[model samples]
Structures are given as C-alpha cells and as structure tokens.
Target: MKDTKILLLLVIGVPILGLVYCAFMIGFLLLVPWGQNHPIITAAIFVLTPSIVSGSIWLISSARAKK
Candidate 1:
C-alpha cells in the first residue's frame, strides 16, 4: 500500500515537475533574447532540457525499483 502510494506520487509528480522545468527553460530562452542570437545555447537548452527531466525520472524510478 505504501509503495503504491509512493509510485502513484512519482507517476503524477515527475511529469508535472518535468513540464514545469521545461516551461521555465523555454521562458528563459524567450526572455533572454541573447539566447536567440546563439544557436549553440538554444540547442543546448532544447536538447538538455528533456534529457535532464528524463534522467531525473529514470533515477527516481530506478531507486524505487531497488527498494
């Protein structure tokens, strides 16, 4: 029962956090017009943003699995 709750929370929470994080990154890109001038920075953010979120989710899920 407890694990189920934790899993449920993880399922619900990670995506929300990921989306929020991605939104924030995008907003940062928009606000920082300098980012538009630099393709590398923009590309880094676009690529790294999903990786960071998915990596975090994977870490959490793996940790939970170990438990």
Candidate 2:
C-alpha cells in the first residue's frame, strides 16, 4: 500500500468507523428496555468505545506502514 493511501485512510477510516461503532453501541444501549440505567456507564461507553476503536485503527495503520 502506498503512503498516500494509508494517510488518506487514516484520515477517513478512523473517524468513520469510530463514529459508527459509537452510534451502534449507544443506539443499542438506548433501544434496549432492560439494563442498568446508569449515566456513567453510558458516558463511558460514549467515550471509551470510540477511543479504543480509533486507537486500534491507528495502531493497525502504524503496523501496516512498518510492513
């Protein structure tokens, strides 16, 4: 893969995938009728999941660049 391609993907893919994951997770959480209705947990889900996913994407891209 080319450097430009990798950079472009990192610019685009990280936010897109991270947001998708966050939306999906939060949407599912809200859609459910049962569960511990905790605000902190919800906040953590909003923050952590996307962050971890984005970081993972970045790490993967870094690894790929090394290869």
Candidate 3:
C-alpha cells in the first residue's frame, strides 16, 4: 500500500510539475523583446532546461524503483 501510494503520487505529480514549469518558461519568453540577439540560444535554453530537470527526476525515480 505504501509503494502504491508513492507510485500514484509520482504519476500525478511529475507531469503537473513539468507543465507548471513549462508554463512559467513560456510566460518568461513572452516578456522578452522579439528583436533580441541570439534567439537560437535563448530558445535552446528555454526548451532544454526544463526537460533536463524533469528528465532527471524521472530517471531518478525509475532507478530507485528498480533497486
């Protein structure tokens, strides 16, 4: 029962957290000027940063589950 609860929490929590983070990033992006230089780097930073965080969380959780 404890393991089931933890699994349920992870299933629900991670995506909601990821979506909230993504929304925050999008809001931040909208505030930036359109003519800013290095748009590619800015875009890459925005896109990659959250995925790295969420991916790491997912990897850690899965690894712990396997142990």
* Candidate with the greatest TM-score versus the true structure: 1
Best by lDDT: 1
**Cα-lDDT of candidate 1:** 0.86
Give the range of the ten consecutive residues with the poorest summed lDDT in model 1.
21-30
For candidate 2, the per-residue lDDT at 55 reads: 100
Which residue pairs show collisions in model 2? none
Ranking by TM-score: 1, 3, 2
Q: Give all candidates' CA lDDT scores.
A: 0.86, 0.80, 0.81
User: C-alpha displacement of 59 in model 2, angstroms?
Assistant: 8.8
Write model 2 residue lDDT over 37-63, tens digit each, in one string: 766676787778757987999999999
Model 2, poorest ten-residue lDDT window?
32-41
For 1-67, candidate 3 gives per-residue lDDT tens digits of 6998999989999889879977876776677675155578877887798789879999999999999
User: For residues 1-67, what per-residue lDDT tens digits would candidate 1 score against the true structure?
Assistant: 6999999989999899879878977787788888768969788877887889879999999999999
**lDDT score, candidate 1, position 36:** 67
List TM-scores for all candidates, in order.
0.58, 0.54, 0.57
> Which residue pairs show backbone clashes in model 1?
none
